[model samples]
Every structure is written in structure tokens, then in C-alpha cells.
Target: MKLTREEITAALVGLLGADSVIVEPVRMDPYLREPRKRFHQPAAAIALPHDVPALQALARWANEHRVPLIPQGGNTGLVGGQVPLGENEVVVSLVRLDKVRALNAEAGHMTLEAGVVLETAQSLAADAGALFPLYLASQGSARIGGVLSSNAGGVQVLAYGNARELCLGVEAVLADGRLYQGLGSLRKDNTGYDLKDLLIGAEGTLGFITAATLKLFPMPQGHETALCSVNSPEAALALFYDMRRRAAGTLTAFEIIPAFGLDIQLRHRMLDRDPTAGPSPWYCLLEISRPAGGPEGTLMAALEAAFESGGVDDAVIAESLEERARMWAFREQMSECQSREGASIKHDVSVPIAAVPELIARGSEAAVNLLPGIRPCPFGHMGDGNIHFNFSQPVDADPKAFMAGAEPIHAAIYEIVVGLGGSVSAEHGIGQLKTGLLASVKDPVALQMMAAIKAALDPHGILNPGKLLPPSP
Candidate 1:
């Protein structure tokens, strides 16, 4: 009952037109290339279904043939979930299905196809006089379906929530080609099982997402942005608490940046000019979203309070839109700036807000002890307790030699993170990058339950095979 490559291509051409099927390896290269370049296996063929019905048909045929299919969108996922794992798999690109089904700004919702780009979705909401509010550096290329599938969390997750919370409902095609039409703009629904939630973050193993109903919010009048100078991580934590008590929900983003970030930016000339208040051991980029008819200067007043109370050394509030953009630029370019420094080890982990200070302090000591003079750039989403704890390669050291010692560095930091009850992956999911770490860190009982669910949903192991769930012990 096995289908050869020729037969699989013939069946795909039968369901969809010949133009929709790609069998040549050279032509299918773009679909296989992911952002990370970590996964490089070639797919059997790349299938581009032009419509939802065709996609469902292909999925059903693939399921019956025991052929693996990887659902891909803009191909912008940092994790390798959007690319193929083996030559036996095929990638189904969702680009052609991009469309806006409906938009109701007053009702605060919109229905969109899975293939719509995140930036385009933001533009659509802006045109309707509302805000989608899920902003990421990859928004220009990241698709709605991939965003929801990964349950991505961006900077503003401190206020709004992640992609899962923003999605109201999803319509997906199951493994057997049955359409699960669950799209709606309902604010409250006491539904059974919460199937929509299950499929949102399933990474296409359970089903192929076709469309979704997403939540929107009223446009903020403006934002109060500031760059603060702190002597240490403990001071940054105290400043965050002061800002939270003062602004509450309006305190949308509180990101930490180390002094090395600015050094790299300056050395690489990544910024047009200096954006910080001055020099300090640490910097915190704080933001407050001002609602309609709300008072301004709340962020400035809170910074002044922190300054007087010795929580912050100095601060620079953005006086113009250009300055605000520059401050954000410094924070957003932290990851890219590290690449310029040479080889680096990165971990996106989160602990309790109260434990963040300890996580940073203990983690820094461990990495420093393991490798002397290893620059630690521990920053990001301090309000969410998610720090992108990355270590820059030691100065004047060989990149290969530095990377070879990454294991001990990772082990040391993860030990501190686990001891503090933190998650190894704060935003990025368990793609091919973190499968080994997941096996070691995840609860045994939870892993068993996940295996059972994966077995039931993908009985043939054809959908995104060898992902998320580790192999049974």
C-alpha cells in the first residue's frame, strides 16, 4: 500500500492541477530553506494547494498514503516547525489562501485567512481604525497561521497576551480531510473541549489551519517611551515594580538591555546615534500605552519617583517620535547585534517576576565561572519575566572553540532557571532546536500524555513528523 514518488506526484496532480505540484528538488529549494538554516533536509515534493478545498483533499490523500505533510506559511518561523524534517515529507505552502474574510473594528474582531502576513493584518486593522497589537520583528514575513500555530509572544505580551490569547477561533482541516469550521468572533462561548485552543498551538501535527477569527483592540492615543540607566539587574527589577504600581496595564513593555548591547551597536554602527541616557551597567526600556482621553506623563512621573527612591540612576524620556524609535531600535536589534560580535549562545527562558533578579544574578555568576570573560547579554521582556539570556563569545577566542564549550554554559544557566521554576522556552516552541532539552527538562507524566495525544491525532505520524513530542523512553 506504499506510494512511490512518481505516484504521489501523480495523485497530487490529479487532486490539484499539474502546475500546483512541484517534484524537482531545485525548484523546491525555497520552501525547504527555513530562517534558521538548521534543518536542511529536502522534501519529497512541494505542494501548493490554491484553495482550502484542494488543501483538504491533499491532506486526506496524504493521510491515506501515510505520507508526511508539513504546513508552511511565510517560512519566517525562528523554529524549524515550518520546514521539512525528512525526504519522505512534503510541504504545503499556504501563501495563495491569503484573504481578509471580514473586519468589524467597532465589535473589536476580524476574520482572516491563514496565509495573510502579520504586517498586512496590522495594516488591515489600521485601515479599519483599530489595532491588532501583535508586533514582532518578523511581522513583515511571518504569517497569521504560523504565528497562531507557534503561539508566538512578542514584546507587548506583557499587556495584551500571546498569539493564542489573541485568536478567538480557528478553522482547520483534520488528518482525514474533514473541515473543522470553528471560526467566529465570539467574546464568550462555553464550548466543550476547547478544540480551537488545542489546534492553535498544535504546530500542524493535529490539523492544517485554514482560517482564524482574531481579536482587535482600540488604538492607543500614544506611547510614553523611556530608556533608564540602572546599576544592576536588581535595580532594573525594582524600577519595573515601581513602574507597574504606577501604570498597571498601561505599562505595556518593560525590556532589559545590558551595557554590552550598546557597545556592540556602537562598534557595529547599527544605530545612527546613542539612544541611552548615558553609561550604566544595565538599561531598561520601558513603555506605557496611553489610552484615548487618558492623562500623559505617567511614565515620566514614575521614572522620577524611581530616580528619587534610588531605584534608577538616570533616565532619558523620548521627546520626539524619532527618539522613541531610536530607543526601540536599540532594544529590537539586541539579537542581531550579537551576531556581529561572533559566535554566541542564546536561551529564551522565564521565571517568576520575583525570581528574575536571582535568575540573572546566579546565571551570570555561573556563566562567568564556567568561561572567564564571556560577555553575558541577559535582556528582554522583564515584565513578563522572560529574559533572552544570551552569552557573547569571549573576546579574541576562536568561534568554533567557543561554541564547543556551549554545553556547559547551557547546562549551568538551565540549572539556575529550573531551580527558580522557569520555562526553558519562553516564546519559541519546541522545534528541532530544543527537542533534547525538552526531553530532559519536561515532566515525565506530561510527556506521556503528550505522546498519547500525538498518537491519537496523527495516527500515521504523517503531519510534521518527529517534532514537539520526544521519542518514548
Candidate 2:
């Protein structure tokens, strides 16, 4: 027998103190709404567990009563993974669990609770004379738990790695209130099946990531940043090859941006001035990190070679730290600048590095054929093959109408992505938005395997129901 809403609230208040349970609808608003504003559903109550024991008790009670629980971090997830799906579920906000358990900077690792803000973690590493290379726009609010759950990838993924690669291990609470104490700082743990990797990208479907031990690196002495003009994506790719061949591991970031990106940033006054050298069809923002005793002018030497080979026409290397910041502002503001234009159809897809130019050409043509005058803004980590393919509505077009007819555009881009042996959803995991798409494209055997894993861990189907995995036929 299912409990009524009032009964559920009372039961929660009984378990945790009345102060920890929020029954007011207004107070529950923040936990229900996500970044994309796509998924909106009421939650029974917001449960605030102050410590691991409290969270474990809540999970055990939830399992017994079959109450669906949505584990949320700082509530900054792009997908609906961190929000509630229906009125029957309860959102477990982990903000109060913020704590720094251990920090061995010299040893290159630190253990932090799930609620520790990502930016705070970065500051902690810096204070210890080390570096945490995972940098994201949402790092100001995104927590370590959701970061690991989604396996987030940001600008530095080209050199360091994604959230999964940066994490050494995780400590989680299972569905039945048992603890999976897997946190460690070991560089080598050739043990049995790697449960750490399995839970890191599970998106809260497997368990609630309570804490984690993350990897750190030595701080770079300095950085070499530049924005270069490339005639086309092919030229950018050639330049990237030359840079990688020359700089090797020092080539930290290689981002590509179309001319339109710069235009809108300037038009909206998002930037004080144009950061590129001059107007060109495309631009590549490349950066190389200089070690403590490393030589400088590596980027300059590579650009000279690139210019002679006709891969680059013009370029502007940052002469000061302020110039470097402006160069990055141009790239980081790409997504925000598009919203000022109008409604945009976006696809976070990725293909092979060599096929990026082809992906952009074919995708732009396909979108234009379907909806003429559609502005395509394809830019992102070109070095890692993940392009944030987005299309803005035509001038003076109705936002609602444009969004209503977005099906064909989405279909066209995903089809091209799949045809080129690319992932339909890159970086961002298949939160409720792409479950159906994942079902259509994912291998059947792989889906079955995922289902088996879900059943083995969460038999009651209470941990983030109707997420990550597709519905049963």
C-alpha cells in the first residue's frame, strides 16, 4: 500500500527532524527546477540529510516504502538527472554534506564530500600548491557528486581528462542503506571488476555518490594562448596536427569557433572588443602550458610553421594575462551569446577528429535544407572531437514556432552524427532527454547489460526512476 502525501511528509519528518524536511511547495521549488528548464514535476518533500548516517536511514526507509528518491547535488545539472520526475518522488539534496575529509596535495589526491562545490575544491587544491584541472562554467555551483555522476567534460578535457578520469575512487550508499566504501588515493588497484568506474558515470541511477577521492596535478608555470584565423575547418585540423606534433603533451586546449560566434558576442556587447586578429571564416583558440623550467615561445614557433604551410592566415598571441582572459571569454561565452539571438536547436554530438570538418559541413547543409536561414554555431573541443552543434532561429521568427518545428533539425543532426560513427550525446549523458534516442541508437546487447546492472543494484527501482535507462517495452 502506498502512503499518502501527508503521510509521506509526516514519515519523513519523523525520520529526520522537522527542520530537515521541507513540505512547503515554495521551498521545494529550487530542487525541482533544473538548468535547462525542460523537466518540471512536483516532489513530495525535500529531504536534507546532514550526514552519511542520516542519508543511509532515509534510503533504507525509502526502500521499505518504495518511495522514489532523486539524489541532487548543487542542482546545476544540464540534463534532468538531478531533478524529480513526478509528484511521488522525494528530492534528497546533499548540500549539507559538504566537507573536506582529507587533502594530500603532495601525494596528488584529496577526499571530499559530495556537496563540496567544484570551485571550492579547485581553490583547495590551489591553496595546497597543486591543481585540479577539471574546469567547467557551472563549476561555481556544480558539486563533486553530480560532477562524477554525469562524468562532466570541460575545456581542459583535451589535456587532463573528464570527471571519470580525474576521480580515483568513490564512496556511495547503496539502495538498501549499505555503504560502498571505495574511496582511496592509490594509483594502482588492479583488483576485480572496477566498481569505481561503473558508479562514476551512472548518473545517480546506481547509487548516491556521498564522497570521492580526486586526482590532482602540478601547477603549470605559465600559459601560451592564441587565437588564429583559419580559412576552413580542414585548415584548423591541419594546424591542430602540426601543434600536437610540435607541443605534444603541452597542447592543453585546441578549440574551434566560427566567425558568427565572434559576431554575436560583439553585437550583444558580451565582449569589450574582438579578440581575434581579423575577420575570417573560422578561428581556433589554442593554448600550451609551460612547465616550471620549460622554454617559452612554443606556440609562436608552431604558428610560424602553420602560416608558412598556408594553414593559418593571421593570428594574435596574448601578450599579457588580461589579453589571455579576453581570449578565453570569447570562447566560454559561446553558449550564452546564442540565447540572446533567439531560440536555438542544440546538439552536443561528437565525431572523429578528422571528420569534424565533414560533420560541420554536412550538418549545416542539412539544417539549411530543412529550415533556410538557420544560423549554425558549431564550436567546442575540436581536439577531442566534441562539437556543440547549435542552430539559432531565423530573424524575427517566433520562438515558440521555431521550437515546435525542432524535430526535423534534431533528427537530421543525430542521423549525420550516427552515420559518421559519432555519439548522438557527447559529454552530457543521456538524462531523461535522450533516453529514447539512446534506445534507438544504442546496441541492444549493451542496453540489456545496463538493465541487468540496474536490477542487481537497485531491485526496487527507487533510485532515480525513469532516468538514464529507457522504459520497458
Candidate 3:
């Protein structure tokens, strides 16, 4: 026989004090509310362990009782990964574990506790005269543990790589309460299978990430940002290739935005002023980092070459830090601005950087074919080809009615993505949001391997019971 909610709460409170275990529904409200608001099921209780030992104790207690425990950090994930899946589960929040365990800028890495906010981690590196280089829109509230658990990829991924690459090592508590102490700052270790990679993007299905050793880069002397106007996705792609060829690894970000995105942001007053050079069919926000003692005008020279070659229609280079912020604000506020317009369906998908134009063209065309007058807002990391393919409600359409018609649009988009060798869930992990989609599109052999590994690590299925992996075939 299994324990009831009351019994589970009592057991958790026994491991952690009553102050740490929140059984009341009202007090658990904050942890329950996810950013996307898609998954609404309530968790039985919220467990806020004070440190690693307390968390291990709580996990051990829950594992023995077969009580599902959902590990959460920051609670800022777009997919339903960080939220409760069912009423029987308990959310183990690492928010109280915020700490900077170690910082060694000279050695090019830092050890941070899971609860340290993403922005705080960046600031810590900046204080040490280094750069963390994992720039995310939700970094202000997204914590280290959740970021690593999700294996987040943000704007600077073109050069710095994703959360998985940026993370050198991790410390996690397994489903059965054993801690995996893999936090080593070494660059090369060919001893055995990479357990850190397994846990980084596991979405709490196998273990709860308690801390991480993150790779850092030398702080750039300055940044050169530009918003270039392009006539079409093809032109944007050409420009991206040109920029990459010219700037190479120095090219930090290459984000593409549609006119629809610009319209929504301006309408919502999300930006103080327009950041683009002028109106066009599309815009590319490309940036380059200036290394210490490096010559200026590398980005400008590249842009000049693009203009000469007719790859860019027009461009506005950020002359000041304020201009740079506004330019990035226009890019970062893409998702929030869509919400202001009304109901929008979002897909965090990716294709090859070269195939981006085809993906956007076919995806948008399919979406339009399915629903006449559907507004497509295909924007985001063009350098890495991860577009947040989103669709806004038709003019004057009811939000509920529009959302009701999301299935066909999703099907059209995913079919094209898979056909073109693109990913259905690019930056966002296969949380509850895309488990069904993952099953349909992911390779059967890959799924089998995932299930086998999951079974090996979390035989009890007590950690994030219904997330990431799908039901076995």
C-alpha cells in the first residue's frame, strides 16, 4: 500500500521540519504556477530543503515511500518540466540552496549552488573579471540548478554553446538518495561514460541537480551590436553566413525577427523606440564580441562587405550601451510581446543554420494553409537555427477559439521540421509539453536507449514520474 498525501507530508516534515514542508495548498500556490500556464495539476506539497543533506534526506524518504518528487529551480521554464504533473507528486524546490560555492576566474570556471539565480551567476563572473557567457532571457529569475537541469540554450549559444557545453560538471542527488559527486573543473576526463551529460538535460527525471561547475570565458572588452534589415529569410541566411565567415567564433549572436514581432512589440510598448534601421520584411540582430586589445570595426567591416555585396538592405549599429540594450530588448521581448497580442502557440524548434530559410518558409506556409489569416511570428537564434516558431491569433479572433485550433498548426510545423532533419523541441527540453510530440518524432532506437538509461538510474520512477521520457513501446 502507498502513503496518502497526509502521510507523505508527515514523512517529508519528519525529514525536513514543519517549516520546510508546506502542506497547505495556499502556501504551495507559488511553486504550482508555471510560466507557460499549460500544466495546471496541483502537487500534494512543496518541500523546501535548506541544503544538500536535507534534500538528500527528503528524497530518500520520498523514494522509500514511492512518492514522486518533482525537482524545481526558479520555476521559470517555458515547458511544464519544472511543475507538478499530478496531485500525488511533491515539488522539491532548491530556491533556498542559493550559494556561490567557488569562483576561480584565473582557472576559467566557477562552482555555483543550484539555487543561485542565473543573473547572479553572471554577475559573480563579471565581478571576477570573467564572463559566464550563458545569456538567457529568463536569467534574472532562472536558477543554476534549473538552468542546468533544462540544459538551456540562449542568445550567445552561437559562440559560447548551450548549458550542457558550458557546464563542466554537476552534483546531483539520485532517485534512491545517493549523491552523484561529479563536480570536477577539469576539461578532459575519459574515464567512463559521461554521467554529467546524462543528468544535465534529464529534466529531473533521473536526479536533482544540486550544484554545477560552469565554464567561463575571458570577458570581452566590448560588444558590437547591429540590427540589419533583410528583405527575406534567404537574405538573412546569406547575411548570417557572411557574418560567420567574417567574425568566426567572435560572432556571438545572430537572431532573426519578423515584421510581425516588431509590430507586436511596438504595439505593446515593450520598447521605448524602434531599434531597427527601418521597416522591412525581416530583421537580423547580429552581434560580435571585441576581445581585449582587439581592433575595433571588425563587425563594421563585415557589415560594409555585406552592404557592398547587397546581402544587407540597411543596418543600425549600436553607438552606445543604451542603444545596445534597446536593440537586445527588441529581441529578448519577442515572447512577452506576443502574449500582449492575444493567444499564441509557441514551438521552440531548430534546423541547420543553412536550412533555416526553408524551415521558416515551409513552416509559415503550412501554418497559413491550415488556418487562413493566422499570423506567424518565426523569430530567434538564427545563427544556431533555433526559431521560436509561434503563431498569433487571427485579428479579432477569440483567444480560446484560436487555441482550440492549435493542433493542425502544430502538426503541419512538426511534419516539416522532421522532414527537413530539424528538431521539434530545440532549446526547450522534452518536458511534459512535448512528451507526446517527442514520442511521435524522436527515433525509436533513441527512445529505447533513453528508457533503458532511465530505468537504470531511476528504477523506482519516483523522480519527476511522467516527464521527459515517454511510455515504453
Candidate 2 wrongly placed segments (more than 4 Å): none
Better of 2 and 3 by lDDT: 2
Cα lDDT of candidate 2 equals 0.93
Error of 3 at 28 (Å): 0.6
lDDT values, one for every candidate: 0.89, 0.93, 0.91
Candidate 3 lDDT trough over 10 residues, lowest sum? 464-473
Query: After best superposition, candidate 3 residue 13: deviation in angstroms?
Result: 1.3
Q: Candidate 3 at residue 461, lDDT?
A: 91
Which 10-residue window of candidate 2 scores lowest in summed lDDT?
Answer: 77-86
Per-candidate clashes, comma-separated? 0, 0, 0
**Taking the tens digit of each residue's C-alpha lDDT, what string does model 1 give over 1-473?**
76777787888889999999898878999899987567788777899888899998998889988999999988887668889888778899888889899999999999999999999999999899899999888999989988888888999999999999999999998888989999977888986788888887778888889899999999999999999999988888888888999999999999999999999999999999999989998999999999999999999789888878999898899999999999999999999999999988889899998899899889999999999989998999999999999999989989889999999999998889999999998887877777788899999898887888878877888888877777657
What's the TM-score of each model vs. the native? 0.97, 0.99, 0.99
Pairs of residues clashing in candidate 1: none
Give the alpha carbon lDDT tens digit for every residue of 127-182 in model 2: 99899999888899999999999999999898998999999999999999999999
Cα lDDT tens digits, model 3, 150-268, are: 98999999998999999999999998889999999999999999999999889999899999999989999999999999999999999999999999888999999999889888888
Model 1, residue 337: displacement in angstroms? 0.9
